[model samples]
Target: MNKHCCNDMTYHANFKCDIHKDLFECPDKLIFFHERDNDYGLIIHDGGSSSIEILFCPWCGKKL
Candidate 1:
């Protein structure tokens, strides 16, 4: 599934799910590193393991 970010990055501060319209906070970390043309990706911590996967926002239950 194609991942989607919140329309407003600060939505988590208010504890509101952008997609579900419920009280929740997104745990997905925003990646600042850019490769080319302002392309970016999210960083999901995996206990320092080589395995990495883009997880969904637990609050909204949507791909992050």
Candidate 2:
């Protein structure tokens, strides 16, 4: 697991389940962290599997 700015960020980023096919398949997943891009995003549950890149941590206010 990657280190995040705070517990909230870490918790949300690490929350995952094998039962779901992907991030979009899990409705509880609201925050996403892209390992390759090294960025964070707010997951959009619009059935398009799209997300909005976020620059800072919503919980800690730290630059992501």
Candidate 3:
């Protein structure tokens, strides 16, 4: 398996750090998001436990 380093790949798959460079606090489940109705906020569900993280959220709370 080829695990990429945090400093290697950009959050939004970019060649370099852009908007989320300095302020990019990349979480384990951080990913891109695109939706309708502007469904903001989050929903907390039971996702078990882990040493890393088990939560999921849209990038920047759907800000992306």
Best by TM-score: 2
C-alpha lDDT score of every prediction, in listed order = 0.36, 0.88, 0.28
Error of 2 at 9 (Å): 0.4
Question: Best candidate, lDDT-wise?
Answer: 2
Q: Mind giving the per-residue lDDT tens digits that candidate 1 earns over 1-64?
A: 4223553423332333356432212344334223243333343445331222335543455554
- Model 2 stretches astray by more than 4 angstroms: none
- RMSD of each candidate relative to the true structure: 10.7, 1.9, 13.4
Point out the worst 10-residue segment of candidate 2 by lDDT.
Answer: 17-26
The total of clashing pairs for model 3 equals 0
Q: Encode model 3's per-residue lDDT on 1-64: one tens digit a residue.
A: 4122233223433333344343123333232222242222221223422222213323322211
What is the descending lDDT order? 2, 1, 3
Query: Model 2: per-residue lDDT, tens digit, 1-64?
Result: 6578899999899888678878877898989888888888999988878999999999889998
| lDDT value, candidate 1, whole model | 0.36
- Order of all candidates by TM-score, from best down to worst? 2, 1, 3
lDDT for model 2, please.
0.88
> Model 1: clashing residue pairs?
none
